[model samples]
Target: MSKKDKNSSNSRRDFMKTSATALAGFYIVPRHVLGGPGFIAPSDKLRVASVGVGGMGGGDVRGIYGTGKVDMIALCDVDDSRAKQSVEAHPKAKYYKDFRVMLENEENNIDAVSVSTPDHMHAVIAMMAMKMGKHVYVQKPMAHDIYEARMLTEAASKYKVVTQMGNQGSSGDGVRKMVEWYDAGLIGEATKVYSWTNRPVWPQGIPWPEKGQTPPKDLDWDLWLGTAPYKDYVENLVPFNWRGWWDYGTGALGDMACHIMEPPFRVLGLGYPKSAECSVGSVYVGEFQQGYFPESCPPSSHITLRFDRPGKEDLEFHWMDGGIQPTRPEELEANEQMGDGGNGVIIEGTKGKMMCSTYGINPQLLPTSKTKDINVPETLYRVPKGDQGHYANWVEACIGGYGSKEFDLLSSPFSVAGPLTESVLMGNLAIRSYDYRAPRKENQNQFDYPGRGIKLLWDGENMKITNFEPANQFVKRQYQGDYSL
Candidate 1:
């Protein structure tokens, strides 16, 4: 076996040992001796804390509450006004305005934490939680930048904590069924994928707003900035509209790519992409077009990503925003219409085609005949039934439920990160590059960045561009303070 393979195997074994001892209610020594970071043992009812308890965080809390195996012990958010209703809902739970203070004060009380902050704050909060021996469920896109994603993945391994990315779609019945069908060869070699979303209900591309409005009393503007460079709080940027901006949000792609692309990324084992480039239409270029663009960044954008699959030929994945969808495939039957609203994914295989949406839940398979075929696989992969439930699957596994057969942290690899993040970042780069110029309908060989559209090679281990320097630089971001991932 290769040295890397040997190291990975060693890490898994160490994680299992540390996890087993913790589940048995033993101190298990410092995990440093076990070649992995230590974790706290499973305690009664699993005391839980929540960071960023608004927006998606509230939904996450509801899901965890659905499990009935956790107690809502604490809640944290920079915006007190947004969290006020949640705090009232969970009258028994303590509340805090900063995550750092919540983590330190509630260390012994919190067995796990649900991190539902914006993309930028995810890595920092999650890393701190795992270091404190708390199980973590971080919302998707996973990290603001590539470096942070790699760091979180590494920390999950090192800390031997039960970790779940809050892409809830990952736990759905249809998503697992899609993976099973692909594994059973329902469709031969998926070479191309098309995923799109109609997002940014908030304004886009508008120039930055003038400094006029006073900050809300319930909001702590400075704490909300966290690790990101400071900017004055504006009504356009806060509450729930940050996704359209450059600094705090990742636009439409970051908002929905994790849900739309989850199936294809999981089934094909498509790891990091080789390179990505983007082009967009002009309606969104103007500074004040329909007042959509936040005074901070572009209003609407489109991007196309070209990825090179190792040991296989190159693949092209296209993404569109502002209600754009792929040209209907000729092979699709008349009944197979791409539905309206939200996000969906269309995968074109050598043999046939498949499309799934609503985050792959209750998906519809096409060729109509394929749906009625009896020879097709019947047994779909399902998460095992348990007292802890689906949201707690990773946590239960950490407590040594099934020995070596338990869910391995590495089972779901970082394949989703490279392509998904690339697509999202491409939108940001395009808005910055072309200033949201007239949308380029035709695919071009050369993007403004030399070799931007060219097929490049990726070394996942080293997280480097074997061929393209510009693309490599795109993967790494400048850290603002002590935050280095």
Candidate 2:
């Protein structure tokens, strides 16, 4: 190895040795010698570094730090203005603009990483941390694409690292209750599931800006772009609104499905989808004039996915976004609210049905009255503090090390979240394919959307579309410059 590489490796080794001694040196002493039997030494706490410390990322930092078992050692974000709150809140944390630099310099000081970056950057940052043997807690959906999700899942095992996806609903009691109900046969065999959300609260189905503007002084536009293809800075793109664009975000499905669909996904033991098809709402510029904005996600969409179970028939799953919703179940009362009024889920079985709002909150059986009538023993373990315990779950697991009991209790480990994320991104694949345009064989001027009006068969193990080669583009995207899995 080169001299610099050797020296860096040596430094990391020395730091790790020192940290190990500090963490365990007192273990040899009696309980009373350390003040009390239940006392936790300061060195025993998990040290964490956060990336993209703004917006939802900031919330993640607070959740993890609030556990009181973690030390916020480092913070990183491309936008200083956006990260101001987190920076001021954790004044002791060493801050950096680029996560790459922070991870490189603080590799031995921190035991874990919290990645709350944009969808495109999640995989790259989390993958790097895992490769360095640092535990990782990544925001949902776990990755930007199916391939990245798969890789992150595999890396977690290969690296023997503790991992969790930021889908707090996985730890919610509502989902646990649903799981127990399904196991007790209250809902029978679920044949279909419907999930919807009134998302894209951000802009979507619109054309890209015609011109560029200078970025805010505190923002590092290039770093914010990360793995996405180069684009000139535009106003209102920072802090929010990136969700509508294909390059930096995964659209509405990516933003909400992890929380809304996770309950059913966990309750049903769902795997990769067998097939996917979708229809998108269009934007109209004038009377009878359709606006083609391929760069942005559609304003609305309804996606149908099929999954094959071992003994039963295929299960059909429907996803609706952009204020769209499934047909209200007759069992639901006319006056009662459905799925928190805006976002919710309904699992339909042969004999009955159950539903819940976002984050698996307020799960209920059909006929609302049946919710109280049917009671089943809780078979699944509930996470402490329910949904809010998600952060502490990861923190405790990191301190306990991989394969520990705490690690086994993680609600949304990469093993589970990876497949769930793949299922979520599968919807996006179909939606992007919906906008696929190719020249007609007979006419050079006309175009046809081949991806529409047909179902795309998927090979989950291979991560490919067996029926159409064109749709495979969405399975994995080209990483611009040095950014890659």
Strongest candidate by lDDT: 2
Q: Please, what are the lDDT tens digits per residue for candidate 1 over residues 1-485?
A: 22453354334323312232332443334334444333333443667899988877888887776666678999999888788777888999999988889999999887788889888888899889988877777787778766677777778767766677766666566666666667667777788888887776776555566584667988888778777776778875777788766677776777777777766766565545545565544344443244333224444455665655555677777777767778877766666567334567877787777777756765545664565562555453355442124575655544432232344422232233434444455445434431233434444111243433444455555766566565555455665666644
Q: Pick the candidate with the highest TM-score.
A: 2
The digit string of per-residue lDDT tens for model 2 on 145-204 reads 899999999999899998999999888889888877887899888999999999989999
Q: Find the 10 residues in a row with the least total lDDT in model 1.
A: 12-21
lDDT at 294, model 1: 23
Q: How much is 218 displaced in model 1, in angstroms?
A: 0.3
Off by over 4 Å in 2: 1-43, 286-289, 434-448
RMSD after Cα superposition, model 2: 8.8
Each model's total of backbone clashes: 14, 0
Q: What is the TM-score of each candidate against the true structure?
A: 0.79, 0.89
